[model samples]
Target: MLQSLQSVAFAEISLAGDLISANRGFYVLLQLAPDSVVDHVGPYINNPSFTELAAGAQRAMPGQVVYQGLITFLGELGEPRSLLARVCRQGDHLAMIAEHDVRENENLLAAVMDLNEELAEQQRALARANRQLAAEKAEQQRLLQELATAQAHLVQSAQLVSLGQLAAGVAHEINNPISFVRANVATLGGYVGDLLAIIDAYAAGEALLAQDPSLLARIHRLRERCDLDFVRGDAVAVVAESAAGIARVARIVSDLKNFARINESEWQVADLHACLESTLNVASHELRGSAEVVRQYGPLPALHCCPGQLNQVFMNLLLNAIQSLEGAGNGPGRIFLRTGRQDDQGWIEIEDNGRGIGPERLPRIFEPFYTTRAIGAGTGLGLSSAWGIINAHGGRIEVRTEVGKGSTFRIWLPLSRTTSE
Candidate 1:
């Protein structure tokens, strides 16, 4: 039986998991020495079932097959090798018979390797796609922010243009009536003086009237009935007051005309103080009910700028100051307007004693569409547009405030237009 097992390809192991013997074919397959085969089965077999294989070898009867299956093992080069293997009992020993199944194994390994490569490629593609999507998301966010700013600018510019047109119309329509009324009051003042002189002459002729006592009595009765002394004094005073009032109206209309010149769309030599005065007149209604405005004028050089745009900036600033006071409700508010020149630059300051901005919110005031007011009450583009206009004019605006105290906005403009522009 041993000779027959040796003729076939076979190996024998003891119950203690030691290699007892092996045929010439088995030795050739595993590249093992026949003399060193004993107790060396672990070096050649790759599976962790050697102890169970040894036990099966001891329990099987003669000529009975103990196990039959495909198995893997390590060859002389330490590379994986597969075989069709079987174990059978022969007396007290078990013989393992095996043959290489190379063709079937090669086909199975190629299919598994192709599937793994495909899975790796899929994961790499997914990673690249994720990176691209992240970049696109970032770009979209930037574009959205830019669009919001542009929209706010457009709306603010439209509002300023409309206001300019309205002011121009008002100034034009009221100019004629205001002129005539002013002139009539001036003429009436002279006429009242002449009539009072005539009444005086009649009084001086009282002595001559003694020649006709009846005529003198008639004149005395008429003077007593009409109260001529009071009429003469009151008529002069009334004409003077009317003239002063008309003068004030004319001044207001003139300011309106100046404020509306922003529609010219060209730069001109501008008086900053004059612009401030005009803006104050235009904003008088808002200020009168809420605060007292104090003007501190200074000698400032003329600026080469777009007067209308500067007037718009002044309007926004004044409105903001007035509204701040209106919200405080701590009694009447105070607004201070100061103008000065330093280092050939002109500066105007609009300071208010009202509710001040909190520190956290102060930084974002100039951002487009950012407002602290209720949603429908404010459009939030005033400061943003103001800042843009100032920047284009080569100027800057500075702000200082303390919570519960007040706020001050200072604007400095270039004395001359940039030659490049």
Candidate 2:
């Protein structure tokens, strides 16, 4: 125990509160005592404070060991000296070891204290660096998550924007034909009523027929007003075209309602034939101006799918085919839409004779934001969304195209095992 204590920084204290003794290490370090041999006292060492302090210590302490730390004075080195001493302890016996050897112990102790201070500083610096690294890691994770979320939202927004522009353009083209047809129907209704009244007078009796030239005159007047000569060639063609036009308008409105239906609870298994027809009806206005549509239908099974969303897929495919044609330029432009079911596989192909995409562009056609169209023309989400929907239904899509030829998009839906669910 004593050696372990000695191995600590060398220190010695007197048995009481006065400067009876100090270690040589302490002596060289701070001159707590004037003489070098203080740790081991020589003969004739004397001081009343030491004696009194020892006596007081024994009295105060009773049977315990009496070492009390205190301040005392040592003789000064210079002439006309300043009295000097530092706080130290007094001991009981005045004389002990004979020599002062403190320089090495003092130097080692000072060096150890300095090293301790340096170690403490290093520990604090390491802790600060660890905290900073943790904070940076957390910040990086947060930014990565935000980036993923923002990118997903951007994809959805871009898709909706493209759909909006397509809807606006298609609606405009359809309205013009409907407006003319509606007006012609109202005019024909009036002309038919006049002809019916004139026929009633001619059949009334000879007297009524011969009453005056008024009936004949009235007939002539009606014919003049109705433009009989123009109607001779135009009326039949106009009425036939108008009937077809009104039906087209009604069909488009129905397709729009079915395609954009938000009331999902009303969903049911819809026949592919009906769905295809309605989709073509709604899209005809966009396609009519640029491409002729031909349908080749083989027997197909009804799909138990989200009607509105599946219609959206059709709309996307049909529009994409049309856009490809427009890019090619008008000429022998045609879109062939065919549907079939065979060997438990359902298939659809939308083929167009238009400017074809290159081999490099084809692979990325279904990727979001991939487009060959000019800016403001495409968001490139059409095929991607269609792809997603088809895949969700346990299906897949295939594309075939070559330069200056055209592209054919084929969609295949397999028989789902998960029964209508």
Candidate 3:
């Protein structure tokens, strides 16, 4: 059975979110016992390279994969395990992730990393196009960088540009190929190693169980002990995996195009609900099994705002909601989204009935990396980006959360549908 994974077949993995290991092959794979990964903690390894590489990968990959880097986990017993992980991110941040099969050859990893070069190329082309259309795009990118850090430019002159003062044409030329390559990254996001793992585990265990009759006898003994009369009815078990995959292609095309459009200028009107719906759809297959999302959107009007940027806002909020539930525990937690109107005020609220935030930490919810979640589990930009978008649209964002109850975010926007148009 494990022999099948070596050739070709896709499998799902739990190395990133819930457990250190997940293979469709059988419970034995989970029981084969991960040496280092913790049963409750999942795969969280202590390694700097893993984090940087995963971050770089997430920055590069667009549709299917979201790199979470190397994770270390302590097994059921005293053992440490490491795994490369990623999430599915069509916008910014990750929704789903997995650790892939490790390649023996380092060169293969380097070759695959070419996708980043492609993303860079896309940004480059977008920049050149921006230079021609909107004079402020360069500054916009720079300002975005500043938004993440303490870096800022006190400009006395009217001209706007990046802090690097980089050679724009050269950047463009280099980025062209990058954009070309990134377009295909989703195709490669398949967790081939994960798919191979279950079969691999079954085969690995079957082989070991073959060497000694005691192991087989022990299995039979445990089968009765655990009430596993027909446990191994089928010789092989396949992991259940669902990604946007082929259906995701169209959405990918739409996002890339929208990214290009939004990146071109800061002015555009978008349906806030539509953007949220798209982000939810893009992240749908990723969140289906692990968490359940409940949305309650009230009547909303078309917003004269940047759809791409708004999509980013929706992405951040939803991701934060998911992470909150994840951090709370693997139980039945609910995430709710509410939208409605209040005369001159219209709001979109995202509420999570998961782990709630404290009053002390509540003040800094929008601060960069200000998270209650474990270190690697969060970047803390989701709410902040949501804040930035809602603010830019002439809106207000506030959080109402309790330490144990849950967290709720209310984003107020001026209904420009009637005013702007």
Candidate 4:
């Protein structure tokens, strides 16, 4: 409401006679510029000095009239003008209202018109400043987003480096023992077969020595005590099972090495099916009791991509599917992996029968540090990193999800590397 009365010549002055603030009308009456610095009221008053006004205000109570009379004001051109003034005590300050005489009304009106034009120009300047500030703010936001993306990439690189080192170490440490044990199991199996043949030969000789019934009875008792028949059959089965177990361990280590791809950092034309298999094998422990995987693999050609990075993507998606199933209630959890080639692109789809994403959260699922999982359960960068890697490979990812049912993520990559890549 006070801002609406711009034409009123009102001023607030301190007890020490310093000019506090004034409206456009006051500046116009004094013939001063709109943004002029009027430090003291003493220099502007020609009739009564500000000292006399302060003394008068000190004698009156707050909200009481201090001085009511004509005051002579000195304009910028040193022209003295007399105007009717009323001063009131307002708390620690003095409020003054001044009005020009009837004969000087025309001059006051002209000055007011000039003040309005100056005010309009100032407003325009303020508006331009606001626009510039807004643009600068938007630029800052863009830079921050770029910084976040760069940080996420750095984190993913570090993780991959660590994984590669670990995989290399495990493969080296486990492969030697696996090879020795495998060979030992094969030799032991042959030794057991020869021992069983000797036992059978001894049994036949016992029949030949039937002339000594006591010797035959003693041999029968010894065989029964040792459970020779059961041992003969179980021994070969145990050795075979041990060899198979050793082979499975070797396969797992190989799969881990393949999934890590420590030595294959550069782009290559590789089998996508092999990559998927390696990833599945690497995450076998996590999927064992949680979710059953179903594969619907189609004929796909070798795709030009970073095998390690694609493996990382597959790992992330597979782990998320497994976790989702774990969180789903006591129903059977299933994950479907599908791959196919369409035109020049090959697509891999991972779908889960677990709790799905809601509408509000679907859009930001790939945003870094945005997660629906409980704190410490996830880093929230899995999907974001996957998205970044696919984009870097000149590929794209699509998501299809429904609440309470499940979610499907399909990654589409070009069969051949593009020139831009």
Candidate 5:
């Protein structure tokens, strides 16, 4: 067994610490000649406890002793190599030594540590990228919210401007009826004075009639001269007319109030014709001089919408139609306001027989700040804001026109409740 073990390429040493022989494998591992290895055996070994190992090996049974140590070859400055060695004593002549290489295991440990650090670096980079992307997304959302808020304010401003334009016409409409009511009241005041005088004359003369028969004739002459009967008949007519005038003024004011009250933003179910009527009345002053309005009101259902916003939209389109008729000389322009429902949709059409939109300008008319009207005469926000409102209400506006002939603006709204701003 000992000879076969040596043949398997283990090194051997004598009891005197001299290398007896070594196999080709040992010389190949150290890249040394067997003669050179034998010559330097004692000096080449780095272990200081080899003497103890040797003593232990001498007493130990064959193939029963093991030594774990590092070996440094002579004249080599490289790190010592780790080895697992086994010692076998044979017949008091020699001990056999065998070694296994463990240097690659150390190199593997260093490579693994480097790979762990590299992986940690990549993880940090990915985490930073994720943070940057999150910040950018948050900023984008904030800007979008600001933009939406600005658009809402712009639409509200346009509505207020449209109402300001109607103020003059509303005042005029109210003033006309008030003027007549005041005049009738003044006439009635004069009639009251004359009738009171006649009453005083009759009441005083009744006592005098017993004393003098001429007193009754004087009372009759006073009534005839004052024309009390005619005054009494006319006063009834004047009072009735004055009441009608007051009612007319009240109606105009009520309509104006209804139109103005549409500023609420919440959606509600409302009559489409009522909204149209209010809008028309508000724009009546603009229409009076520029065009004559003809209502072609059709059957329409109550629709769910923001009534105030819809009123704003209706006023905008109606005002635009009236303004388009500005130069229709010789006769008043005609504006046809129509409403109807078909299927699940309700529509309003404002058509005018006046100057129509040019084909080039028509496409851009709904663009913000785009207008064909003279500067200071229009803010150019009316139609654009109207478009935004209708869109937000789940509705749309359509237009048809021929240059110099006429133009029509039609708005179609869904009957169901719609989400809006």
Candidate 6:
């Protein structure tokens, strides 16, 4: 039975550590020939050899087994193996049992540890990849938002260009008739003045006709039916009023032409004050009752810029100011337009005395489609468009505001196109 056992090795030794006998399994496990005569087990038992086993056996109580959990053993060829072993004292000898199956369990545990390390590394790499993916997603979203804003700007610019062309055509068509009407009205006023002089002379000659009573009576009846005195005074006033009205129409046409300079698409030297005045005139109806515009213009050199574009910017700022005031209760509102030249730049400032923008909404005022106004009340692109136009001109817009007070938007433009570029 002892020789037939293949995994458990049994041995018996002297209490003085001499090898007495051993199973055939012990010789086979240690790689020794079956007929080999081993003098001692010291060479085969690498760790906890025969000497250490003997001492451990002596320390134990009588017939008690001491288990050495795992011990390294060497073969005759110096190969190493591990065994779970136990030793016991019996009579004048020691009995030992060692199991070769413990080595398989140790190898399995080592493999499990290596797998755990690889799994941990893979988890760390997945976490880093997730972080990178998150960053890329955020960047993509930002880029998409920018693209949407750019498209909106392009659409708005196209609409403005079309509107400007229409305004220019309309102004041109009105200018021709208005010019002839103005000249004819002036001529009519002169003819009316000459006719009034002749009527006065006829009135003076009527005294001579008083000598003929019947003729005088007839003349007096004609004068009474005609109301000649009132006619003489009212005709001159009516003609003058017509002339004035025609002149006003002509001025409006001129202002409209100036405001929508479709022909002046390219950069050119333009008066900043003139541009502002033309814009104000074009938007006069919007300001008529909503607010009062006060101009505080200073001396400034002509600027190199697209006048139509600048006029559009001015119109936006002015309209914004007017709306701000209109929203502020029933009190009369004031819009102050100020201009000046500082260093190499000329600046135009539009200020209003109305309820101003809150700090929470101030920073994003120039962001596309961002607004504090109620839905449908505003498209929210006016300020942003103005900002874009100024930036394209190598200029900037500065805003100053207080919660309940008002806001001021100052536009700074370079004096020369070369410098601005």
Q: Against the true structure, whose TM-score is highest?
A: 4
- What's the TM-score of each model vs. the native? 0.63, 0.51, 0.41, 0.68, 0.53, 0.64
Which residue ranges in model 5 land beyond 4 Å of their true spot? Answer: 1-230, 329-331
lDDT of each: 0.79, 0.60, 0.54, 0.83, 0.69, 0.80
Angstrom error at residue 201, model 2:
1.8
Best by lDDT: 4
Error of 2 at 77 (Å): 62
Q: Tell me model 1's lDDT, rounded to 2 decimals.
A: 0.79
Ranking by lDDT: 4, 6, 1, 5, 2, 3
Give the candidate order by descending TM-score.
Answer: 4, 6, 1, 5, 2, 3
In model 3, where do residues sit more than 4 Å from their true spots? 1-248, 255-264, 327-330, 375-377, 417-421
Poorly placed runs, candidate 4 (over 4 Å): 1-143, 207-222, 419-421
lDDT of 5 by residue, 1-421 (tens): 3233222335667656777767665554455654464553554455534465567667854444334344333323334543444444543534434345345323433443454456557768989999999999999998976775577567666566566446545756776777777687767767776876877677776866857768777767987998978866776677777777777676677777667655566677888898888787767777776677888999888888877778888888888777778785526689898999888888999999778888788888887666777888776778888888889889899999988888999999988766654
- Where's the lowest-lDDT run of ten residues in candidate 6? 104-113
RMSD of 5: 22.5
In model 3, where is the ten-residue run with the lowest total lDDT? 156-165
Q: Could you tell me the TM-score of candidate 6? A: 0.64
Clashes of each: 0, 5, 29, 0, 1, 0
Return the TM-score for candidate 2, rounded to 2 decimals: 0.51
Looking at candidate 5, the ten consecutive residues that score lowest on lDDT are 1-10
Model 1 residue-pair collision total: 0
Task: Tell me the tens digit of each residue's lDDT in model 1 across 1-421.
Answer: 4223332346767655566776676766676655553455766775636666667767765556677676566778787666777766655666676755544334433443454456557767988999999999999999999999889878877877888899899999999999888888888888888888988988898899989999999988998899887887789889988988888888899999999876566878888888999889888889886899998988888888889989999999999998888667657799999999898788999999889999999999999989999989998888998998898788999999987778999999878676333
- lDDT of model 6 at position 109: 34
Backbone clash pairs for candidate 1 read none
